[model samples]
Each structure stands twice: as C-alpha cells, then as structure tokens.
Target: MKFIDEYLSDIKDKGLYRELKFFNRPQSKYTSIGNKRMLLMASNNYLDLCNDDRLKDAAEKAIHTYGVGSGGSRLTTGSYELHDQLEKKIAIFKGTEAAILFNTGYMANIGTITAIADKEWIIFSDALNHASIIDGCRLSGAKIVVYKHCDMDDLQEKIKVYKGNKRFIVTDGVFSMDGDIAPLDKIVKLAKENNILTMVDDAHGTGVLGDNGTGCVEYFNLKGQVDIQLGTLSKALASEGGFVAGTKSLVTYLRHKARSFIYSTALSPAMIAVSLCSLDIVKNEKERRVKLLENSKWFQWELRKLGFNVLESNTVIIALVIGNAEKTIKLSEKLFEKGIFISAIRPPTVPEHTSRLRITLMSSHNREELKYVLDKLKEAGMELGII
Candidate 1:
C-alpha cells in the first residue's frame, strides 16, 4: 500500500495523474457529466448511433428474446445464432470471404498476432501502431522491427535485412492519435513483392471510410489483397466487440486456434443486436458519413486558420498538440468550464512533449455547436498563448 501511494504521488507530482469523471447520461451531441451539460467532442461515437432509436429497439428486442448474458466462453456454451449472424453480416459488409468476432479489438489483435507468428517469424511494425498491436508482437515472440511512422523506405530496408522464414507487417489503418492514414496501397504492393503477410487494425476506419463505410482496405480498393482486416464495433458502430474479416481459411484457423477468442465469453446478445442494427444503418445511410466528414473538415480548417497546429489529420479525429502535460490539462479544464467536453491526452498514450487535446466530431454536431466550440477555443487559446 505504501508503494502504491508513493507511485500515485509521483504521478500526480508529474502532472500525469488521471481520474475518471462520470457522465450519467447516454452518449450524444450533448453529454451531461454530473450537473453540467456540455457539447461533446471527445467521444469515438463518430456516427452518433449510440443512442439511435433503431439500435435501442434492436437491443431491447434482443434482451427480451436472448436474455442478458452469454453463459460462457465461445468454445463452451456462449456461441449462439446471433453471434453467427453478426459474423456473417460483418464479412459481407467488409467484402471478405468470412469473419469472426472477438470480445474486444485489443483481444482480436493480441489473439490473431500471437496465433500466427512465433519466434521463427519477423514482424515489421509501424512506430505509431496501437498499444494492443505492440503487445501482440511482444506476446508472439516474433522479432519486431519498428520503422518510422508511415515510412515505406524504412520498412523495405528492415524487411531486406531480415532473413526470417516467415514475416508479417502490421499497422493501424487510421492512426488513432494523429488521425493520418497508413499508406495501405504502398504497403500491399510491398507485401506482395516480399511475400510477407499484411494485417491492418481498422478500429477507427470501419463505418467511416470508403464509399459505403467498408473501411480503409475497401477505400483503397485493396479488398482481397491484404491478408487480415481487423476492426471494432464499439467505435463507429456504436456497440461492443471486435471482428477479423478475411478468407474462410483464415477465419477458420483463428476460430480454432486463437486463445483469446477460445477462452473469452462471447459478447452479450443485446450488444450483438446493436452492432447488427448499426451495420444495417451504415449500409443504408450515406448522409451520416457525409455530414461527419464535412464537420471534420470545417472544424479542422477553422482551427488551422486560427494558426493552431492540427497535425496531418484527414479524419473525424483531430489533435491540437499543446506539448506540456499540465498546460493541456488546464486547457481541457477551461473548455469544460465553457461547456465543451474534450479530452486532454497525455503520455504514455502518446509520446512525451506531445500532449494534446484529442477532439473528435460526430455527424449529429450542428453548425451552431461547432461555432460555439470554435469561439470558446479561440478565446482559450489566446488566453493560454496556445494559438
């Protein structure tokens, strides 16, 4: 207990301590945290489908029909018709031969990587890959070679130096923090040239990118070319669980061999129903994607015009790099006081000296809400000299 107290004190002294603030309401354009109602800009509910009537109806019906919980791990008593139905819908949505669901995106990455790669294999990873992927590589016992973020030349150079029997290259489809896209076209080309397998964690891209929101792989027109396409239902889909879409053979192999999927309890029936309904909405509603992209572009343009550094973002996720952790926290607090809810992201989620306000836009955010946010941001930025 003394050691734990000392460690917490050290973190607080460093201005890196984090505490949770409860929001006693559903996720939407406006969120109620305690007694304050604020415009939400820190959520991953990019499509604003979390509280949609259709999804709620589906969840309610599922609860009535299927009950509240899955009985056990998928390999035991948890597999049900809803689980198989969601997997099929996901595969069709992703334009893959088949798909399999997991408890979470983190588990999907960890399970898939460790199942396929071993000490004899080499994994060439992006420096800015998600923490789950990093852990996956470590657990795989594979030789990890990290290249500079999105540096194709560095990746090629590292692959040339490695003479391993098997090789896999993994990266995020859309980097979560920086909001820039991976060069998947070039990556696929290189993978083909080197006979190396490829995997993309499209947690942020699914239900947002591409013509019909099929994700980055389909957006790049490399659907069948990439080996593994992984994503989560919690982000844009406004539900819970993760999925891997690929050839029937790959899905079969993971279903049998991935320890995480084998041992973890299946997603609840209500959550599965929510994801299914979300997919149906994503397929039919193109307006949501358009609105989301427009809002993101307008917000980014306004911020950049105010001389704020928004990095190289081309998605709904945007970051204002504040450099110092304490300053970032202060700015976030200021925004909250102004009735705007945004996140102050600090290490080790991001690197040191790169603390930021990670802002995200949803399709449901109106022009008035955006204008208000911008106005308050400008006022705060001037006050803090962040602009």
Candidate 2:
C-alpha cells in the first residue's frame, strides 16, 4: 500500500495525524495515563455520572440476569425484554410515540437518514452538522444543500432554490466541536411553513439540556413539532447506545429499511440496563446539570479573561480557537505536561486555520480544579503565543 504510506506522510507533514492515548483509570474529572494522574477536561461525561456506583450496580444486576453479549441481531434471537423496555422508556423520555435503538449515535444518524431519504429526496442540512449526518446524506443518494451554520435566512433561501416534494432538514442540536446550538425553533417554523420534515441529532444535548434533561426538543418547547429526534446514551447518560425517537411508523420503517439497525447485534442487556438507570438519574439529579452549566459559564469567562478566543456557547462544551494546527497541538502538549488533558482539535474536525482546544467540563469539577486548569492554560497559551 504505497498510497497508504503517502497519505500518512502527507497528514504528518500537515500536522493532521492522530494517535490514541490510553487511560488506565475510569473516565472522570481525573484519570491516570502512564502512571501520571491527569486532570481530564475533554470528556463527554458532562453530568459526571460515568463512575457512579448506581450505574455499576445496574450493569452488574443486568449481567447476572442476562449474560453479556446479545446473541444475534434484533430481528433474530438477540431481541430481549430489556431491549423492548429501554426502547419504550426512550420514547417516553423524548416525548415521542415510539423509538428504536442502534449500536451508536453515528449508526443512528447514518441509518435513520438513509432510511428516510433517498434519490428522490432533497436534504437541507446545516453546514456544521456532524460528519455522521453528512455521511448519511451522501449514502442516501439525495441532493444535499448545506446552508450557512445556524443561519435561518440561508436555509430559507436554499429551501426556495431546491424544490422537492420529499424534502427534509437535518441538523445537530448541539454542534460537537464549535459548541454552538442550532436554532431549532426557527428551523421548526421553517419546516412547518415549507411543509418539510425536520430531524435533530441531539447527541450533545441529551441529559445536558431542557428542564428535565429530555434534550433539545424539550429545551425549545417544541415537544412534538420536530419529526425525528436522535440521541446517544454514551455522553451524559454514561452508557453505550444510540436511539431515534419519532412516530411509531418511522420506527417501524427504520426497523425494516435501516441497514445499520437491521444487521448489527443488539446492545447488551447490561449496557441497556445502565442506560435505563442513568436516564432515571439524569431526571432525578437535575442539580448536576445545573451546576455543570454554571461552572461552564464561569470557566469560559475566565478563559476569555486570560485572552483566549473562546467561542460563545451555552452548553458544557467549550471551544478555544487557536487558528494553527501545529500550535494547537503544542498548546495541548504543554497543558498535558502541566497535568491537564484537553484535546487539540485539528483539520477535518474543524475548518482549516481554525484549529482549537475542545475543552469539556464535568459537573463534578469544582472551582478549585477549574482555576488550576485556567492557570495552566494561561501559561501554555502565553508560551505558544496563542493569547
């Protein structure tokens, strides 16, 4: 594979190459890497429930009831009572008529989009939608029209230009890298006026938004207005699985047509149980998310006070733009050496010359730990000439 070597060399030269960093401890505000206890600031466990004992107990109980792996695909012998219960629970949580589960959020997006739209359809997607949505639109063989990020006017203009009866708009409820939320209320209005369908992948919003942590749909107070609601159990829920909530007919259609759902093995009973328990925790422990958001606001303000270009975000995900890929990596490395772990997001994940440090905060992180992180970031930013 000469081409593979060439590609690797090209990325290395461009400072776009990526490698894995192994963690020796459970995912939390603090974790160990190679015997060094590092402060974790780049995890998606926003509510800090990943290491909760209750979730562990739930998983263990489910494991005792049903052995680990799901025997087969959902349509086969893999279907369990626990799976059915979770799906029903998800529907109730999201305020939808029904719901279906997938192996991951990526799978859910790719599967649902392809299942709903095809060659005859046109998809008006947000410019900053997650890559999974982009892939799903591409695989569907539909004409994809990308509007400017979170610009409703651009969407309206494109909607008028791309005329199709079978048209739907898909967007990420909360963009992962930029940490900005899409204008779902305006999108829903446009969809209604234009007679188009709407889908929102609330992967980052689930368990971290809305009064009851029901996600973006509830956050916007447009409960039953949106057509398809997609989410993941992995983020704040601290579990592993993806799901789509919509009308019963849509769930039925996806089960028959979505290849990712029809072919992949069902999620294990233990993971499903963990998801179930975590959802309950998210509902009961609203204070966790409340504190998480409060700390995020304080943290972002502090970063700006240090002269960093922090993006405007209401969610826990924060983006501190550094513009240069190599410099961003250097800043991350410097911070790591200072006992903090924040990811350097580079090209392809973000726009060129817009490399950034994607810092995420957990509810369990206190002011003392955050102040320490800010201090470290200030030192690194000054050394790298980022501030």
Which 10-residue window in model 2 sums to the lowest lDDT?
378-387
Cα-based lDDT for every prediction: 0.94, 0.95
Ten consecutive residues with minimal summed lDDT in candidate 1? Answer: 307-316
* Cα TM-score per model: 0.99, 0.99
* Tens-digit per-residue lDDT, 25-94, candidate 1: 8999887988999899999999999999999999999999999999989889998899999999999999
Per-residue CA lDDT of model 2 for 1-387, tens digit only, reads: 999999999999999999899999999999999999999999999988888999999999999999999999999988999999999999999999999999999999999999989899999999889999999999999999999999999999999999978999999999999999899999999999999999999999999999998888998999999999999999999999999999999999999999999999999999999999999999899999999999999999999999999999999999999999999999999999989999999989898999999999999999999999998888888888888
**Local error of candidate 1 at 181, Å?**
0.5
lDDT of 1: 0.94
Pairs with backbone N, CA or C atoms under 3 Å apart (clashes), candidate 1: none
State in Å the error of residue 339, model 2: 1.0
